[model samples]
Target chain A: MRDASEPGALPTPGGPRVRLLDADSAPLLVRDHFAGGDPGPIVASLAQVPELVGPTLPFLGAVLGPSWIPLREKEIVILRTSAVMGCRYCTDTHTVVALDSGLGRDEVRALRGDLPVAGAFSDAYERALISWCDAVAFGIESDIRPARAALDADDARVVELTLLVATTVMLNRYATALGLPVSVDARARLAEEAL
Target chain B: MTALATALADESLGGRVWFYTNYHCNLTCSYCLTESGPKVARRELDRATVLDLAREAKDLGFSQIGITGGEPFLVTDLPELLAELAGVLPVLVLTNGTLFQRALLDRIAPLGDADVSLQISLDHPDPVANDVMRGPENFRKVVEAVPALLALGIAVRIATTLEDGDADDLPRLCILHRSLGVGDEDHVVRPILRRGRAETGDMGVRARYLDLPPELTITADGAFWSPFAPTVRGGSLDTDLLLSRTVRPLQRPVDAMITVLSGRPEGADSTLNIR
Candidate 1:
């Protein structure tokens, strides 16, 4: 967990492998992401390598930001992917993000694998989504019938959702491998808010 | 006030405006910043565009104009281009000094009356040591060319690119340049940057965007952070230091640079001062 009380703090168990850039140190393209906001350790780490920012940031923005798919569905894919991969940093950070995206606390806990999905997610489509996320993350074959029916066999949505999961897995590996601590704002919000 | 306000006012590193006239060179130096050679594409900026940028640069607070490239002289209209640019601001042209033969010399004879000085690359005092990196006949061409250019009353400056091992040779190079009629003030020694062809080599230092000063550079591809910004690696243009693709209006890139500069932290000096 990161200490949220201070500005520009990175209290990972051991120090990060690469230099983390603050607003002053980050270049023009990346400075806005780190400037006067809680962008977290992921962006700080990315600022060190231009190749990371050049190819990664824009693609992540397109997938993670507003899109044709509902925000709830995208958040579910992100949370489930990070949870499946055991990326604690992303799971913890996205826990707050998921809630802000209108997901129930119990639903987030279910996505994190802390609570059972049956009781938390009453919707049949969401259950199918979680099952699909689990199968894709583990790289094992499973019945795609439930997701195909729930999504009404909409290949575009299915492809987009799957791509979202893949992108989250990519971020999950990067964040977890770097041992990025959760942001202070996320920790504080998680502790105080029941939502 | 922004952080770069004071720093931008100082005319040391990021003061001048740089233009990459083209990207095709005669020699393939091991540490060449742009990976330029006879085989490379000629991404040449025409004479009209250069003159237009020079006119706008003077209004934008640039004190001098620097023209560098695969070799500025490779462009046929460079001599006339330099004379016109010199009318707006003092012009400094970086060259290999190999093309100053009788015909080219006669063509560039008019520049003797212009406010222009040629900066020629001559790395070491020894012909063998210099040619090892810059190519054969480099030392001979530069040695013979400098006197001829000087005889025409054109000011010549010797720019020595020193690697770690070549630091000791500066004194000898200094004596050699002086004997060739170039004064100490006209001689410049700079370190090789770890860019383009020098990226994998075990010499020079690495310079990212923040590592260099914001000396607005205009190229055929785009406007970049510095003269060192527009580089090529593996036969592709490196866009890491690119600021904006718009180069016309000139105000667009100038404003973009100010926006970048305003964000610069205090005392954020360049690691490699190429003076």
Candidate 2:
């Protein structure tokens, strides 16, 4: 991720992709995340990395963000893998996002792997979906890649899942290397701002 | 299994997170870590965001919370923030104790019931001696505030940076701090680790992280895994220290924490760990 290729020149003003913002302008990334909405708690956190405003950031934002991966599937993979990997920062940061994704409170709790996945999600089909999520979380997908047959996830969906896993590592590393914490009610506050 | 291997195999990592509520401080200690000074712009977290972060941290299993700033008391909504966080996790406020007005004290005194304590700096005993490193009259205000805080039934401890002032005189200073009701055990006397504005080794010897534990830090902007190297906006130090977008539904810092905290050389896997 460190091409540092002279950091390809930033786009022009009102360009399609925003440039790497200087520290003074770092707050602009919030609008990038929210589509010109009010800023969120992430603004306070992400503004520190002015480099993210560069040519690659808008692309990286699209790849790692909520655009391609279905929020449900992506959050399940992100939360499950992060929890299983012992990444408190990721798990904490994503729990509310999972809740906001329409997962039940108990379903969210069950996804942590500390509780039985079946107890919270009663439907056998739902359990199978969760089992698939567990396999993705375990990175044991080759054994279960055949099982992708049972769900509505298409071939393109598998690619999205792979992309999500690859990006989760990057996301987790950002928190670990930089020591980012889960802001309280971050998802709710951000949701409130959107409202 | 080794501690790291076992920890790596585990399912969760709990870190105490420090929220830098604002970058405003009353005095500019020569060795201040956050570059906090009178002129530092106010970048405080709102009460909703602070409480939200606290709740999320509790679910993530954080055991402690630290409210720090140019000076935490400089934020008008601090008492309300303290009351909310004190209810969820044991909290410590790393303050200069230079701004403890009774009205502010009344609002936060109930924090004692919530496991909140003050880790106010008292680098030296005599005002003249302490003021040499910190600005003028620092020792007087902190010393005066310490006893009053203790009298309010709020737990108080003296925090000192060894690199900024006299370490040899610590025995004397600790005793003077004890006179203000800070128990001998309550003293947090340590060397100033080179960070933020003090990287030139102008403060003390560089105290690089021998190893990073699973610690979380949320500044006015985003979250991080370590607090040793903070991004000072346009400053010279490497400031690629953010982990997630507060507005999104993804995460990445904990795995990186496990790899580094496991005693592997940093950047062992990727350029993420380059010093």
Highest lDDT scorer: 1
* lDDT tens per residue, model 1, A103-127: 9888998898889999999988888
Error of 1 at B38 (Å): 0.2
Q: Grade the docking of candidate 2.
A: incorrect
lDDT tens per residue, model 1, B87-153:
9999999999999999999998889998999999999999999999999999999999999999888
Q: Score the docking of each candidate (DockQ).
A: 0.05, 0.03
User: Which candidate achieves the best TM-score against the true structure?
Assistant: 1
For each candidate, C-alpha RMSD in Å?
Answer: 10.3, 18.0
Which stretches of candidate 1 lie above 4 Å from their native place?
Answer: A1-27, A31-195, B1-7, B11-13
Clashing pairs in 1: A4-A184
Query: Against the unseen true structure, what C-alpha lDDT does each candidate score?
Result: 0.81, 0.61
TM-score of the first chain of model 1: 0.86
Worst 10 residues of 2 chain B by lDDT: B247-256
